[model samples]
Target chain A: MPRSVRVRLFATARLAVGRAVLPWPVPEHGLRARELVAALEQAYPRLAPTLRGSRFLRNDRYLRDLDETLRPGDEFAVHPPYGGG
Target chain B: MAVRLTRRPLTLAEAERRLRARPGGAVVVFAGRVRRDRRRGSSVVALEYEVDRVPALARLRALERAARRRFGASELVLWHRLGRVRVGEVAVVVGATCPHRVEAFDAARYLIDELKTTVPIWKEERGRPVRRPPRRRARPGVRSAGSGRAP
Candidate 1:
């Protein structure tokens, strides 16, 4: 069975993707954050620009390195620039 | 709680009440309100605020801890309102109580500034179109009531 990771989008990312969450299929060994994002952009052309200006979080923790691996069932969040006050 | 991401309205009075309970010598409160800004030709009627709750709450708590540690603040209130907030409504309140006025002010400023840049919250403005009354239509074969020459 192919492993699946939960991809979550927020703010502008959410707007671009038109959905808050997506179940992404990955390899059994999982894939790097960078690869996952590239795949997402390929899948959703409209989301590419937003992803360029976004930050990534893996399971509630900020993913400072795109090289970080995302395992199955993990939650990956795409955060656009914050506008809170 | 010192850190809050609620859907309810925010108030400076409530923030003051929370911070004043601490034994600090100085307390400062700052409230941010939605403004009726003009976008293009439309007027802003409200702001719809959204948040990625889990991460936002975590960031808020982290900010609260940092404010206390860095400024020696004894009490703090960091509240942000979610959902639709009308113009002039309080959207956020950040306050801190510290041993001195400088620390209190600095902490309050830092809290709000960091929250703006770091928290996973966003606002989209909702605009209303300018209204104009409809023009009166002329009736066929009807005489005007105020006309000097009757028909």
Candidate 2:
């Protein structure tokens, strides 16, 4: 099986991407979180705006900063600001 | 359960019941309902709520613990509806039971405030075009929100 990151989109991000999840390809050596996000924006221009105001998670845990590295098979989730009552 | 994220309508009655009244305990429940507000020149018919269940429930449980520690709450109910909530329908309920009224109210308030700011929940507005009389009327129907059911 090929190495890939599972990118989960929610709410506005889902709307922008037209899907809830994506198999984002990444090098086997892994890459910085920032690089992955930039690549996504380049691939899906409509997602750029939503990405600007979103929080990132890896394996259900929030990323402290974009410096964190994303390895193959990691689940990356994008959460926009909450609006629930 | 101290917290819930469900597709069914949330209710203060259920929340109060979950608290299980005590002889001297005071309960304070805050229920938030959907409103028929206007947006983009259209009337909002319903709000479509979505959630990232794993993180959302974790945060709710965390808030439950915080409420108990901060306000001396003996019991709590934090329930939120997922999916299409029609106008005037209850969308969320957060309540607490404490030995006194002050602590109960404070705990309830804190849960709601924290839940809104921290939970992985979001809502999108579904609108109905305002009828201008001359224009053809839309069919009297609405689609369910996402994969969740509508009431």
Candidate 3:
């Protein structure tokens, strides 16, 4: 079976993609976070601008490095600048 | 219990009560309310707040620990309201209790600032559409220049 990752979008990212969640395909060995983001940008060109300003999360944890590998069935989230108080 | 992301209303009284649980010489509480701001000729009626629950809670907990370690906070309250919050409603309540007034104030400030910049929460304003003035109709027998009526 083909490996996949769950791409979660929040706030502006969700608005740009018009959905809260997306299933993104990946290789069995998974791909680097940078490559996954690039694939997402290619798939949703409108989301490129939002992606540039967003922070990434891997399975509910903030990712400080984009080089981190994302394995199959992992949940990756795109969070725009926070506006909470 | 100190860190919360609720969907219900947040009250200053509740936050104060929570902070009072710990005996401290100084307790500071800050409440953030949704304002009816004007935007593009429209008025903001409410703010819709959304969050990625698991991560938001995790970050809040981390912030709580940091506040305690850095500010010597004996007690802390970092409650934030989710969903649609109307104008003038309390959107968030942050409080800190410390042995001294300075630490309490600083801790409270830090809590709110960090929450805004670090938490995984977002708010979108919902505004009322701008109302335009009704156009005046040319009265009968009133000769308007643009109506092609000779003056």
Per-candidate DockQ values are 0.71, 0.82, 0.88
lDDT of 3 by residue, B95-141 (tens): 99999999999999999999999999999999988898987888898
lDDT of 2 by residue, B1-151 (tens): 7788999877777787878654337988899999988757799999999999999988899899899899888889999999999999999999888989999888988999999989999999998887655745455686434535655
Instruction: Using lDDT, rank the candidates from best to worst.
Output: 3, 1, 2
Candidate 3 lDDT score at position A1: 43
For residue A3, what is the lDDT in candidate 2?
Answer: 83
Best by the TM-score measure: 3
RMSD of each: 6.9, 9.7, 5.1
Overall local distance difference test of candidate 1 = 0.90
Q: Candidate 1 vs candidate 2: which has greater TM-score?
A: 2
Q: What TM-score does the predicted chain A of each candidate obtain versus native chain A?
A: 0.93, 0.94, 0.92
* Candidate 2 docking class: high
Q: Write the per-residue lDDT of candidate 3 for residues A15-67, one digit (tens) a residue.
A: 99999999888876778999989988999999999999999999988898999
- Candidate 1, B96: how far from true, in Å? 0.8
**lDDT (C-alpha) at residue A57 in model 3:** 94
Docking class for model 3 is high
Relative to the true structure, how large is the alpha-carbon lDDT of every model?
Answer: 0.90, 0.89, 0.92
Off by over 4 Å in 1: B131-151
